[model samples]
Target: MPSPAAPPPPVVTPFTGQFGLAYPIICAPMFLVSSASLVIRAGNAGGMGAFPALNYRPLERIREAIRQIREESAAPFAINIIMQKSNRDRYRHLELALEEEIPLIITSLGHPGEAIRLAHQGKCRVYCDVVGLDHARKVADLGADGLVAVSYGAGGHAGTLTPFALIPLLARHFPLPVVAAGGIVDGAGLAAALCLGASAAYMGTRFIASCEAEVTSTYKAAVVAAGCHDIVNTDRVDGYPGNFIRTPALDALGLEPSLVERILSGSRTARRSLARIRATRVLFGAGSSRATYKTVFSAGQCAGLIDDIPSVQQIIEETIRHYHAIKGTLP
Candidate 1:
């Protein structure tokens, strides 16, 4: 129960390499959870905070979120979009980002071409999340300004690539800015990410447990209690391979590991099997595992390293201290 150690390095990631934010940190955009307050707080604290556009209710709610963030903070922030889920209103979201001249926008779960076009014309940067070199290359060619490399431990539709391997590979040939995501918790990890040739560190679990984040107390506690091993990357919940803490609710369901693997791999039966499980038995499956719905809780492997629920400012201060300590040791 000792407090987490002081940060071990001093880092000043260049702001203009990709994201125009002061520090090379981007809060991962959580669907249904990221709020204007949280995003503004992170941006004001010198990191980029993101809210997925899908979280908005009325189309006007999206503009209100953007307006509020701009009113409260001067630092850069981003809006995340589930490109695959974008409907007729996608243009509306992009239109507002353009009219407001937002700093950054990241597109996930789909293509970034149209959004990227809008972002570029408005002088804003467009970022896309990719699981591997192929997708990484595709996004870059789409004229996306950069990529959020979603490797192992990332919350949604994640891939099992090690940062050591993936970062280096993407850094080598991707030809665009790269934000390394997954397993990034404290300053040490952030410092390591920069060392791995990333321009920034995109974090989800760290923000999910924040005081300002719009997560349920039960979900936040689950994050504080989980370690790297606690999260299960499964297809039982959503069709994607997301990470979450293994709860008794999930365990009560007598699903096998092979089935979970098949679905996570995008096997055709994955979606159908999950639908049947949700419809047939109530208690057999845990919270939100049906094909139509998703589990309320999604955690990152970083949960293991984070034990305390610190404020946004506290985290930034501690991270800055670590950035310095690591810099002090460098030649």
Candidate 2:
């Protein structure tokens, strides 16, 4: 008998068909930085861009901002509902997204029961940022459409799991989409995420310094200037450990290694130890990179990967090209 016909190749559908994207890149909902304009721009570029809802604490502004995004872009956008108990007030912000019928919602700092329920009601998609395999399981079980696997060296209050370890574990257990976040800055970085089985890549620090971002020029300059070893993975006082560039702020606190250990161990709350995080923001509003200097500015160790300050569009294009180039290497 003739050899059996070779089995037809499995279909390779574009990832965007499900997520509704032109690209698999996402602009991370950075705290105090992601603007409605910026969010829409990313979406228009064939990807998702997000804003932290807390930035619009005032209900009226929140509604207005949501309306602006709806009016300005038909592309999909997201709002970040912080997952911290301390940010209970942010729940009201979550209500704004639901009320406006936002399409994409990213839950961070906590469980997604509320976000998932709200999104399902609106026929929206929900994603969550997680630090490890356990949180990944929780996000998936809670009915998120996707999980942003935040691994070691992620900016801000992030987790310690390595991307190599976290991605495969999630790929094996979760059927939903996985977006890798952590120390990813270039096109090569984007390629690696896809190769590792992530459906997308979420970025923050690189965009934080962009002209489209709301932070000061001085802060943007600092991001361009810093090198990798300058960063510190500190848990000195924040309830969760996060990465930041070491600066005078950390040194001035005079924290002993033992004290750092206590905070990281969860025996002591950062509320008592690092009471200055809030006060220091006063400096941020005042445009003093000085206070944030020698102090931890929430940045990933990938600072080494970033050099010149580029527009968000430029970063997106460069990364997209690299993603495709890497795909070409797969065969």
Candidate 3:
């Protein structure tokens, strides 16, 4: 009779067990928006946070950031690395991660064989960003610790499949934990993700509007103001389809790949070169912060769901509370 034994807590995800997370949520890494400050805040708040290594230059900064996170919080966090050959810093970043013995490494855009191997040696885990079943199969065979199913509504390099379609597919086909990433911005989305067989929800765009995000105020405001219709996919950013909030600058660049882009994309090397070219022009050309805000603001359809710029702690607390509320209502 002792308070009915408190009704035993509902199981959130296998992800929590894998990493000792208090909640099954990941603040997905955003290229320029994610910062060490964000990671620290999210980690201390009981959710895992990740930042791209590309966000830091001089390479040593990656080492410093990892150490800083460890000093500030005991919670788990991850470093995201673009593993393609085009990323000259990929190998060095991977070495840094291994040397630091970071808790997690998230690989995107290439094979994760080496990452998985090295991470295992260091007692760390590797999660690969996979958009399809074929790619998922490859990484699973390579001994990936988990899979991040990047669906069509995802902010950055999005996939063609919806969360409903991709999450179940990956969950059914692989024994590895599946984390759903897309237009997931709130507790309801988190609940739905778990119901769809995902072990956790990988949320990116929603965190861009957080108080800890280092992005420009203009960018954060844009995300709060935009909606699902305001989001569009364009291949001009990295020669890969990425979701971004529509702005006059983006519209001027058009959504389709140019004839040269199409023609040169016949080989992997050519595609990488073209991606660098376009990224330089569109992503890096805006020299001033204000100019960049007007040009390229990456966001997902989830922008519609995020109306406030709350602190990272508040966001995590609310999401979990709401998740429990929703779970309780289910028969």
Instruction: Quickly count the clashes in candidate 3.
Output: 0
| Pairs that collide, model 3 | none
Cα error, residue 183 of model 3, in Å, equals: 0.9
Candidate 3 on 1-331: residue-level lDDT in tens?
A: 4552222233457899999888888999988888888999988888899999988887888878888888998888999988876577678989998888778899998778988998898878999999999999999999999999999989988999989999999999999899999988888999999999999888899899989899889999999999889998877655678888988777867677678767877888988776665554443443232223235888998998889999888888788878889988998
Residue 76 in model 3: lDDT: 83
Residue-by-residue lDDT tens digits, candidate 2, 110-229? 567887877787867888887777778777887888878888888776777889888777877888788888888877787777778888888888887776877777667767777888
Candidate achieving higher TM-score, 1 or 3: 3
Please give the lDDT score at residue 205 for candidate 3: 91
Q: Rank the candidates by TM-score, best first.
A: 3, 1, 2
lDDT of 2 at 237: 34
Candidate 1, residue 209: lDDT: 81
Superpose all Cα atoms of candidate 3 onto the true structure and report the RMSD in Å to 1 decimal.
Answer: 4.3
